[model samples]
Target: MGEVKVVFQSVDEVMDYLKALEGYSGDLDLQCDHMIVDGKSLLGILSLGVNRLLNLQIYSDNYEELIKKIEFCCRG
Candidate 1:
């Protein structure tokens, strides 16, 4: 699994992030504290709240491309 911390600035950013995930075939998860949800689900992401650093667990080895595409939302 690949892990990276990210934060969404707005609903629109979340939508864009989801769109980026569509290209990946492997399972993905979003973790906030002890809670974990499917990264592909808008409701799951919304439930985690926006503008907060959340861990993105991409279940794939070839996730660099997706990461590059979502650089705008990554928590530096």
Candidate 2:
């Protein structure tokens, strides 16, 4: 498993992020505090609220390409 920190600034950003995540075949989850949601679900992502950094856990060994695609939202 791999992890990355990302922040969504708006609803549009969340939509875009989910679009980028569509290509991922492995299990992907977005977590904030105690809430965890499916990374690919638009509603799930939006439920976490925006403009705050969140933890993304990617459960796959070949996730480098997926990471690169979503790196635009990565927080440092």
Candidate 3:
């Protein structure tokens, strides 16, 4: 699995991020504190609260393409 921290500045960003995630066949999840939700679900991602860095867990070894697609949203 691969992990990264990302932040959604607006609803559009969230939508775009979800779109990127949906293209991948691997499992993707977003976590906030003790809460975890499906990354591809618009409602699930919106429920995580905005303007905060979220922990993204990509559950697959062959997730390089997916990661590259969403790297713009990731924070170093």
Candidate 4:
């Protein structure tokens, strides 16, 4: 699994991120505190909230494209 800390600047970006994730057929999850949601789902991502640190877990070995799409959102 690949893990990264991410922060969404706005709802639009979250939508874009999800769109980018759509091409991948893998399990991706976003976790904030105790809440965890599917990375590819807009509603699920929104539930984790925005502008906060989120732990993104990428379950696929082939995640270069997905990572590239959200690299800007990475926190440090």
RMSD, every candidate, angstroms:
1.0, 1.0, 1.1, 1.3
Q: What's the TM-score of each model vs. the native?
A: 0.92, 0.92, 0.91, 0.88
Candidate 3 shows a clash count of: 0
lDDT of 3 by residue, 1-76 (tens): 8898989999999988877766577888999999999988889999998898899998999867777898879996
Candidate 1 segments exceeding 4 Å error: none
lDDT of each: 0.90, 0.87, 0.86, 0.83
Candidate 4, position 69, lDDT: 76
Residue pair clashes in candidate 2: none
Model 3 regions lying over 4 Å from their true place: none
Better of 2 and 3 by TM-score: 2
Q: lDDT at 39 for candidate 2?
A: 83
List the candidate 4 regions with Cα displacement exceeding 4 Å: none
Candidate 1 structure, TM-score to reference: 0.92
- Model 4, span 18-43: residue lDDT tens: 77666688898899989999878888
Residue 27, candidate 2: how far off, in angstroms? 0.7
Indicate which candidate wins on lDDT.
Answer: 1
Which candidate comes out best when scored by TM-score?
A: 1
- Please say which candidate is ahead in lDDT: 1 or 4: 1
Q: Backbone clashes per model, in order?
A: 0, 0, 0, 0
Error of 3 at 28 (Å): 0.8
